[model samples]
Target chain A: MARKLASEDLTPVAGGGLLHRRLFLKAGLVLATAQTATSLRAEEVAATTPRAKPEDPADPSWIHKPGLPFTGYGTPSKYEKHVVRNIGGNRTPQGDGVSWTPLEELEGIVTPSGLHFERHHDGVPDIDPAVHRLVIHGLVQRPLEFTVANLLRYPMRSRFLFIECGGNSNAGWHEEPIQRPAGSFHGLVSCSEWTGVPLSLLLDEAGVDPKASWVIAEGADAGLLNVSLPLSKLMDDAMVGLYQNGERVRPENGYPLRLIVPGWEGITNVKWLRRLHVTDAPAMTRNETAKYTELLPSGKARMFTFVMDAKSLITSPSPGQKMHGANVYEIRGLAWSGRGKISKVEVSADGGKSWAEAELQDPVMSQCFTRFRSPWAWDGKAALLKSRATDETGYVQPERDVLIKERGREGYFHYNAIVCWAVDEDGTISHVYA
Target chain B: MSMLRCVAALMIAVSVASLAVAEEDTRVKGHIDGAHGSAAVEPAASANMRLGTPLTSDDIAKWDRTIFPDGRGLPPGRGSAKEGRVIYEQKCARCHGEHGEGGTSEELVSGPTPPSPDNPSKAIGSYWPYATTIFDFVRRSMPPAAPGSLSADETYAVTAYLLAANAIIPESAEMNAETLAAVRMPNRDGFIWIDVKK
Candidate 1:
């Protein structure tokens, strides 16, 4: 029998009504407890009962239906149309704009190809693959021009990685949390399975001169965007990606060809790439000089600080969301590091006073997304929840004040501090400096 | 009979002349229409044609768009600080500022120190490490709205003005492609190498 609730029962969680931040995994409180139970029963049946070999080829499940047909291109399921990147372009110029990926609504690591974030200075160029070519010139032993077909024939590997725009989270430098959705605040970053040939392979094919230490990568967009990358990184884990999320790259995300610099900002991973000019030194492009440079308190500027530090954020129970009741819940989110694998993720229910180790999902690849989960109990009390990720390099995420103090108040780019969420008595959640 | 014969001859001549004119009109119209048709679907235009003239070693013999950490990517042009001042007023002052100062939304010529845990200021004279970066950046994207539009000479003039304003280059010194590539920046050695040693 369900008891009628009084109006007073809907009181806030605490003074701020923030929910209990820690995942208090009580009995039977897994986020997917209902589904897990069924799977667990299936495992038990297989272990205890004698298994009989199936004689019939036309099983009931297979006889009635075959799988969906193949498609040249694919879109998200009908139920997932709401998960598209929140595109916002300039009213006058249709091509100039950005789209924020809905990070909070997604689960696990892979960001479906359709939902990858976009930051285009100019409009997306409709390039014909037939005529596309990648030219390697400048300080190389031999200049080579490879068509799209030639590039596809090279050996390739797949990696689950994240590419974040350098300007992302620049809004954090603003005075307030800029209330919106969690995605808008942190959506500029997205992770996907990128498959491509190693850039070193192509550079080797071009016979990079021994003195060539830098390469100027240029894109074919209207802006003719170009930037210089250290040859060391090019020879490292960098890839000339041809696929994203197990399919040919999307036009918005550098279809036909693109460069993937693992763990670096998105700008360096140029889209619609057309040329790479090996050079002895940096090109000092506008991106490296005028923009993406941070002002330090020590009377110096931090220019080519490329690697994105370890960062994590709780998605559900985040801002603009709420809790149902004093029931058990699953606290889940994603953590990643540009330097390497995420070592551990810690969650705090009462601000940063208490932290508990959350379970990291398996198949944790380097420079890839690592999903984390922990159980929590909401005792109808206000609580603050937060997540902090520590990378394999033993670099613990810094607090807001730490980052600000180190980088100075003028610092805007690479804003990766721990994120906190506060739940009110009415179960409404919002961003909090705590 | 003579009047009837004359009328028949006039009608035949008019018909033949009109037929010739119609043929000429069809040929002219067909050529004009074909010339203006959309080429996207036609696949006749070749993008592989060399852009501009073929650049050989000889053609690039004098073009020195290269930069080292010290100074580089400067084009073959020269400008005096005095000339730069006049150029700045006519071209740059509207957006940049009167005395190498910055405008709203534009970075000031002089600036903050390198980014660190404390003081964060970004400016050309104070923070930039290599003088070459300034030349590269100005040449690639600058003047706000009109990027890659400045002449090689104008680019050198603006670069000289900026360097002089930053107190790097002497006020009376001249900056050509060769001299510009020799100027040094304040924070040239102020970078932390990623310690991913094998």
Candidate 2:
């Protein structure tokens, strides 16, 4: 008992066969062609989206046999083993590199903690909760230390936020487009619902001295990694994250505790956090002084450039994904902003010639990933796909060329630019600079 | 508690706190000026919970490991680059190379040419803005495999040797708390600190 999808539903909203979002919202409605069938509407949807059907309906093996018993921890289906962290590259100690989240293989906002992208300084330290301690000292009137049990006594709040490495999307700096999967190419970022006590309360209890301008947060990892964070941020929205996605934080993602500085760069969210030294000046740690700092064309480096900025990526129909030849495909993607919420996301199908606003999924939290979707009709011809995001602050994501011109060719960190995917006539898609 | 409740409380807490925080934009620290509405939830009071134990000066001194740029926390010890050469070969040579040009670890020596976009050397001499960081890093996390294993004297020696290798100091010059903190870095003014508004 549903109304037939009108021909107007199949109208192209933009160039390159981009259709209205309502047409492909429901698979049943898209297929339920009534009187419109046998007309031009039928011809328009001739190669409609294909949903899988069994050779003999209701004869699937999974339902006919006895299901296996479940354990305490359940994993994705065996068939989904391909979806995993793309841990690549060679490092000096083999434990110092990053593993990318397979963005193309997942959807929605929260990244599974197990599959969260990881960038470790040395290696994951096996920490004992009983032995782990967080000491708040230096410039405070009374230096205090808290055990895991002590932290549990405090009232906790949770927020969905993203932690993006400053070096993420550096591959975009290459002269030629890196032909990697969207997730592997730009998956060094992930979102999580981190639950913990607001750091302001703890700092208040410890009684912050008036002279302390910055705090040097140190992790308990092998390198004893550290970074300097502005006191304002820690007081505003940062959390001493003890839980990720409702459970105790995964070890690789900072098990016992992680400093969740909301929208700041990942290094500042020191994992396995052990110390917070309030000081009048920054500690000038190696990570703050040399590593996370971005070199500019002016020869002066940009240090403490903390905000991740606004960025968006089309997960499907991007590089490594293929097209079901000449079909009505629903393009899905994600958008987020560090300054505030994402106000809009636009889809360009004809290489930026024309663009249409994408339908944003609900509950678009501030400083968190926002899901976006657009519908497209491919007529077995070459096409280009790109998505651009604008944050609530009216900051639009710049195009690749525009970004390059502003931040020279050499700057590696904070590369938030539009991404383009070129689809060939033969049903293959690859990364493009356009 | 439902997930939505936590989010709702936080959102209200955030809006209220942001308005309260706008006044103290210039100051760095003090008694918590904002974000107090978060505690305004149930329990009406957090000072009553009274978690965490206070530490004496001796207790803080034991765990206070941060090294500041203005000669605040460098431990008492001294070593010359001459004495550090032997320690460097034995403890650091395999990863850092013989001359600090980089082996498996990062390059430590200054560049043969001036820093340019094409040949930007992020070595200790060309990039790091402070000299005390060298001693702090070595003493805390060095050798890659066994961290915090070097003595104060040995770390000072390695810092002196690396400084000498980069031609920032003389091989005979000893590195102590005072002398090491006094050594000025070439790129001390290379970073833009105007973005500290965060």
Candidate 3:
């Protein structure tokens, strides 16, 4: 039973032919917009549109014949093979690079487990859970080591959280606006359902010394990647994740264990977690002091910047896809922040000249992706599109110019600015600085 | 949740010589807080869930090799830049360049000056804040392919060679644990830590 809305409800909420937010809530209200769909050729329409069946519908070949047997596991439909992670700078044998999630083709907030973006320093190691162990030492009352079986005995909590690389959208610092897909440019961050035991329980079991204020975490990969985090953070909300998406984690995603630090950079959520050493001071690892740190125009570098600020991106009608000739289309996108839940997301269709609030989907979780959408009417004219996000902390995503004025064009990390896509008159969408 | 008090019933298998296990925690031995009870672990009951194989110093020495910037974990080894040059050319030069000016790998030495974002030369001499990091990184993961292949003395020699090449130390200086811990790089004071009581 689809709900209907009157055509009179198609009122422009903002400038440049934007529709009311309620258009999304009412079922099939898109049909009431003068019955105008994207102008499709008769051949393309006939191929997909269902044909009327005779009184006695005949069974198709798949139904008439015996079906294929079930396999041990299942995979995505072969037709959807194009949907995959985009690997960049791939040097295979001596692994070092990253992969981007194709955000434009995805819908809703939850990213599929297989499509989660990956960044490897020395490639994913094949760890046999039978022999792997997590050791807790340094400033503790007793040094204890636990095998995978031991951790599973502890109580577990599940949460939908996000882990964003500190350098996720750093390309925005380019003097010229980078012309790439939304995900390729800003897909280093990903969200998922993680189930694990609270780290405080384990830390308490180890009995942390009064002198310890920092915890150095290291992975089991070839690089032995390490970083120092504030002790309070691990006790507050960090967990040693044992499961992802209700199943044993994949090898590339820390099969045995991963430190899921909510609202922090991805590197701090150390994967293939092998050791935790409590101390009084930070180790000042290479990642912290040399790489992740940002150099400012002031001739100084900003280090230990753990929290990612508010950011949003309009995914649909973005680069790489051609728009249908002059019709109403839904402008949808994703919004998130490391501080807390996203409070609001405002969309603009005229180069940020006029704005309207997009409807946020339900279950707007903290430190998780929030999907937002708004109905847009295009009259076959050129237009600029953008989305701005505001987290619960009252921090709004800054404009490109505003961010540049404060941080400067020299910054190579932590770039979160309003993204704009120019819709050309020919229905071709492209990335633009406007 | 008194994790310390709950230890009144567990026995740790540790000799008197081991400082790794606190003396007070090894007093008792018995069953862990009802592993047979309902699996739903409430915080009150699970506080007593002290589990894991108590590790002795010998059991962890092989894996506990990460060195601190203050040289807390530096092994008892020493090496000089003159000895390091031979090791550098044979093992490190092909990737890091003959002069450590960077070829296929990161630049290890460069002129000491402030690094601007445009000319962001994050070479060791310009950006790295600690001299001990060269030893720490080289020993932990270097040569990009086979990590942990260098012995402690070789790592110290490479550290000495790089430091001398960067003009931070004398070419003839033999670096030991105490000396390496005290060697300050040019940008040692350039770091600023926030959000903690550093």
Off by over 4 Å in 2: A1-5, A25-57, B1-47, B112-114
Local error of candidate 2 at residue A385 (angstroms): 1.3
DockQ of each: 0.08, 0.30, 0.26
How close is every model to the real structure, measured as TM-score? 0.72, 0.87, 0.87
Tens-place lDDT digits, model 3, residues B1-198: 244234322222222223333332333221433233222322222346677677888877866866788988889999999989999998888878899988766687886665765566778887888777788878887756787888989989988988899888899999989999999877776655544556
The TM-score of the first chain in every model comes to 0.84, 0.92, 0.92
Ranking by TM-score: 2, 3, 1
Top candidate by lDDT: 2
lDDT of 3 by residue, A1-434 (tens): 46665576567788777777667677455531211112223346667888785233575546667877887688887756767888985653357788888887688887888988888888898999989999998889888898888787676778898778887878888877777778889888878899987888889888899998999999998878888899999989899999988887778888899999888888899999999988888877787877787777776777778888889999887876667768778888999998999999999989999998999998899999999988887777998999999999999999999998887776577888999999899877788887
lDDT of 1 by residue, B92-177 (tens): 67756788666533554763244345434456766666666666666655554555677877777778888888788888888776
Better model by DockQ: candidate 2 vs candidate 3? 2
DockQ of 2: 0.30
Candidate 2 residue pairs that clash: none
- Per-model TM-score of chain B: 0.58, 0.73, 0.71
lDDT, each prediction:
0.71, 0.82, 0.80
Summarize candidate 1's per-residue lDDT along A1-434 as a digit string, tens digits. Answer: 23453333334333222223332322332332112222335567768987576446666455677878888667677644556678864432346568998877788898888889998866787999988777777787766677777676555678889998887777777768767667878888899999987777677767789988888888766656787888899887888899998889999999789999999988999999888888876666667766677765654556777888898988876775666666656778888888899999888878887687777888787888899876665676888888899999999989888888888667578898888888677777788787
